[model samples]
Target: MTPTAVDASIQRVARFGATERRLHTIHASAFVVMFLTGLVLYVPTLAQVFSNRPVVKGIHLVAAAAWLTALALVAVLGDRRALRRTRREIERFDADDLRWLRRRTPSPQGRLNAGQKVHAILQAALALLFTVSGTLLWLSERNTDLRLPGTIALHDWSMILAGVLVAGHVWIALSPDKLPALRGILRGTVPAGWAASHHPKWQAPPAGSAQRAPRAGPVRLVAAAVVVASGLLVTAAFTGLAFT
Candidate 1:
């Protein structure tokens, strides 16, 4: 079903602003191009159809790299605060999220539903997969004189999987009834009517409409720091392995 009409007056937070929204749009567009190009480049039969196989491969590689970098910056770093807020706002398989999914409750202006939570988590996971695997592939190719042990097969399959997941991600993102979600990304605010109709729970009293901001608890902060350090350590280990 198409998205229910949202009012045009909800005050969206300046969460992603204009530049960030533009980045999001670029990332989304590049993802589609990269996936299609990668598919054509991977299959020998398809590659042979085009006389300029090298050119196509180059385009695919550049597009994927650009999309991956942009996603890491925009969705991961730039939206960390927004993600935390979204998680808090939609914690668990709450009655709210379920209601929205079932069409029992209308969508909230700023509140993301269960489907959105799933999409967000999956997109983050896919980004990590692409980055790590792409790095390994690059290092392996750059210094073939120094052996990087691991199956070329593994790298190829990982790339294929990432491409497939990205395509699926795009399909889900573009599904009908996601206009508010799209608009939220574009304008950074849902209309006031949308806010009331969709997420009455988040609506603050007129006297004190300032809702509490989502703050990363100490535990979450520590956990994220650990993950970052671990990623660095892993990359360093791989580089060391390549040299040795």
Candidate 2:
């Protein structure tokens, strides 16, 4: 129960629900796939080595679509209250968050720090730019003289910024002090002591709720499927508009 006891056997607290874990999994996996495929498409040496531009491009596009779909899926099917709360948490920044960002203080922090919020914002913005730019780039192949200057520039710059964020995120997650959080994301819980120290501001689920225990069960699968399908339908409509 001691804060210094970082072992797995220590008492656990519910840091993430199954929905959050699913969303995180999909986002991380999709991003990795897109990043790798994008690199292959962008690097001349890698392109030559692969000698299959179409395949690489195809994979990247698929990963991007999947990423978007997964987010929408979670939004529609996940716990609305929890999702809304998380959104507010990410958007809310106060003096405490500022101090945390400046490394001035560690206590009185919420589940997410200022840097994490900034990371989320930058990630969402970059993803939007990448998708829009990528769509145009893809369409150009089929439409002669449709090539638009600066499209590639936007996409490339987005990739560069994403790479930077991903690098920093990795470094932070691997640090000794942050390993508990990393495990929390992977397992959907962290030591109660760790939570008490790092995220003292974190709100535990209400009393009499079974959330304190390790509960990794997912949301309803059928419901999640419906949500994912709806998301795809919406994406299709937008894609239709883009093509027009």
Candidate 3:
């Protein structure tokens, strides 16, 4: 085969497996829950706009905390595997993909465009902000001695911004042309053709076969289990073990 034909064939081999898709779906769902719950909790004025203010607020706060825990687990525990896979795909972006991503015209594969990449990074950063702000808010409200200036303001504003950003993320997720990307999340399987079109280099192998530096084992798992169990116990102390 000629050099150009060989390059084309090489590009067709990269694809993400069902595992990554499952992770992405879980992340997306968790973020959506966190965002909506945060909205209901933070915007008391919306109580007038919507009904059952206090109940909604409670639900929102609880969901946001749960999602935060879940996301933290995903990041700390799953990052090693996820980052490796995403990097392989992202690194393979060539001039054509870049141009297609930036162009006004729609793409055939509708892979995550450049905007999605930026938003993903921003979402990660915002998750950090939510963690810090939330902890501070919780502390300030509980302890009389712990005085944090702008704690209330920061929490409120950060949540508001996160809400807006999440809306954008959802819009992108629901975009008409990106059905395949959405399906990848829901069905936990991107067809081989879909992966070939979107991520040319991710088709490296059938996942789990990639060799990389050894990572810490099950530390994140134990940590997550402890945290979730503790949080549940504490919550049960007041709310009767409401797992919802």
The candidate scoring highest on TM-score is 2
> Can you rank all candidates by TM-score, best first?
2, 3, 1
Identify the runs in model 2 with alpha carbons over 4 angstroms from their true place. 1-9, 143-146, 206-244
Task: List CA RMSD, all candidates.
Answer: 8.4, 5.4, 6.5
| lDDT tens per residue, model 3, 106-197 | 44332445566556667667767777876666555557666688776877787777778877777877887667666555643344555665
Candidate 1 TM-score versus the reference? 0.56
Clashing pairs in 3: 14-203, 15-202, 15-203
Estimate TM-scores for all models: 0.56, 0.79, 0.64
184 Cα displacement, candidate 3 (Å): 1.1
lDDT of 2 by residue, 1-244 (tens): 2233233556666677666777788978998998898999889999999987766766676667778778876666667667666789899998898887788565487778788889988887887898789878866876757689999999988989999999999999999999999988877767777777877887644212323323224555666777678667655644443344
lDDT of each: 0.56, 0.75, 0.56
lDDT of residue 244 for candidate 3: 26
Residue-level lDDT for 197 in candidate 2: 81
Supply every candidate's count of residue pairs whose N, Cα or C atoms clash at under 3 angstroms: 10, 0, 3
Best-matching candidate per lDDT: 2
Regions of candidate 3 where Cα sits further than 4 Å from its true position: 1-19, 49-54, 72-79, 87-112, 191-224, 233-244
